[model samples]
Target: MNSSTHLDLAFTALADPTRRAILARLSEGEATVAELARPFSISQPAVSRHLKILEQAGLITTAVDAQRRPRRLEAQGLAELSGWIERLRESWGYNFRRLDQLLAETAPALEPERTGS
Candidate 1:
């Protein structure tokens, strides 16, 4: 996928709580579609759909083994996600610091006059 499409898929895949939970489960170890579906109240097909989204996002992979297809988490896409978040955080952090400095510099000028007559 192109970079923008990859990011769009990654964020959209993560937007659902079920998919996020699936990612968390996969983080522990690889699991079959049935195994992943077991914890949730949703049907196996629904879980399969979530897996498909994750796979399309490049967040997970599956391999066919006998009767089961085991899904495993892939780190590269997650690393890219983390990098994007960190860069945004850093940019905002710097801007906030600059704002704080400007506020500090202007504070004295905004002080009200104290007069006794």
Candidate 2:
């Protein structure tokens, strides 16, 4: 999928607190659905639904191991999201610098009005 689609999926998945918690758990290590469900009050099936969304967003992956399927975090989706955020941060940084410069330039003119000049 393209970058925008991938980002959309990642953000949508991340919009849920439970899904974010799931990702946080996976970041520490891979886990089964049961392990993932233990921290929350929700049922295992509900946790599984969250897992499905995360997997679809490309934020995680599952591995088959006998009777269990363990899920782990996938870096590619997160990397894309981080990169997009970095770009936005840089743009905002530039804008802030320009704003500071503008205020500095206008400061002297405003001083006279403050003195009732």
Candidate 3:
């Protein structure tokens, strides 16, 4: 998928609080659907649904170990998101710097406020 597509998936997957919590849980280590569902009062099936969305977004991946499927965070997905955000931050920083320079250049021309006697 293209960068925009990937970003769209990632953002969509991140839109849910439950999915974000699932990701947080996986950050510590891999977990089964049941384990992931422990924090929330939701059922395992619901957790699995959230997991499915996360998997589609490439934010998480599942590993098969016998009967159990454990899910873990996929670093690359987050890295892609972070990289995109960083680029925007850099662009904004450049714009802010130019604005600062313009203000500095025009500072002297602005008259100082006079105190009312």
Candidate 4:
């Protein structure tokens, strides 16, 4: 998929608090569905649904370990998102700098007012 397409999926998957929480947990280490489901009161199926969405978005991926399918954070997906955000921040910073320069040029210098003693 294209970058925009991946970003769209990632943002949509991240919109849910539960999914975000899941990602946070996976950030620490890979976990089985049961391990991930323990923090929330939700059912295993519900957690699996969230996991499916996350996997679809490329934010997480599964690995086979014996009979367990553990999920872990995908660095490429996170890095893509981070890079996009950093580009935005850099653009905004440049615009702010330009604005400051313009304001400095147009604004009059402040002079101290003397009070009669």
Candidate 5:
């Protein structure tokens, strides 16, 4: 997939709590579709649909082995997401620091006006 579509798919997949939980579970080890469905109340097909989204996002991969298709976490997509989030956080943090400094500098000037009033 192209980079933009890949990111859109990854974010959309992550937007669902159920899918996120599935990813967390997959992180421990690979699991069959049935095993993944066991923790939730949803039907097997529903879980499969969620798995499809995760797979499309490049967050997980399903491998066929005998009669079972095992799902496992694919860390690269998640790592890319984490890096993007961290960069956003850092940018916001720097802006807040600058704002704090500006407010501190203005505080002394405001104090004189308050006292005069």
Candidate 6:
């Protein structure tokens, strides 16, 4: 798990479609800047800029492979995002259970009393 601010940064990084696409590409495996940018019609520098943001957010990491810098997905970042989402889901589950209990408890109160009809 990570701090809220870091999680926020990761969320912000994922907000851009290009960055998201970049992450999606990294998910498959590691690739150099040129390889990553090949699918898009943007310049290599443009891709680098997006990669910088992703790297800052801890979503991706770069490795120096001789003449190339290969980028790959970071597990810690993915885990942090997954942890936040799981917490949210658990909280919603608790809330729904409480609501169900409340509804069940109130059902009898709304029923009319049956006389000797």
Worst 10 residues of 3 by lDDT: 105-114
Tell me the spans in candidate 1 whose CA falls farther than 4 Å from its real position: 64-67, 115-117
Steric overlap count per candidate: 0, 0, 0, 0, 0, 0
Candidate 1: Cα lDDT at 21: 96
What are the runs in model 2 whose C-alpha is more than 4 Å off? 113-117
Whole-model lDDT per candidate: 0.94, 0.94, 0.94, 0.96, 0.92, 0.93
lDDT of 3 by residue, 1-117 (tens): 999999999999999999999998888999999899998988989988999999999899999999999999999999999999999999999999999999999988896988999
- Candidate 6 lDDT score relative to the true structure: 0.93
Residue pairs of candidate 4 with colliding backbone atoms: none
Give the TM-scores of the predictions, in the order they appear. 0.90, 0.91, 0.92, 0.91, 0.86, 0.89
TM-score of 4: 0.91
Model 6, 7-117: lDDT tens digits are 888999999999999898888999999999999999999999999999999999999888989999999889988998999999999999999999999999989998995
Per-candidate alpha-carbon RMSD to the true structure:
1.8, 2.3, 2.5, 2.4, 2.6, 2.1
Query: In model 6, where do residues sit more than 4 Å from their true spots?
Result: 112-117
lDDT of 1: 0.94
Query: Who is ahead in TM-score, 3 or 5?
Result: 3
lDDT of 2 by residue, 1-117 (tens): 998999899999999999999999998999999999999999999999999999999999999999999999988878889999999999999999999999999989888544555
Tell me the deviation in Å of residue 24 in model 1. 1.1
* Best of the two (1, 6) by TM-score: 1
Highest lDDT against the true fold, candidate: 4
How much is 59 displaced in model 3, in angstroms? 0.3
Ranking by TM-score: 3, 4, 2, 1, 6, 5
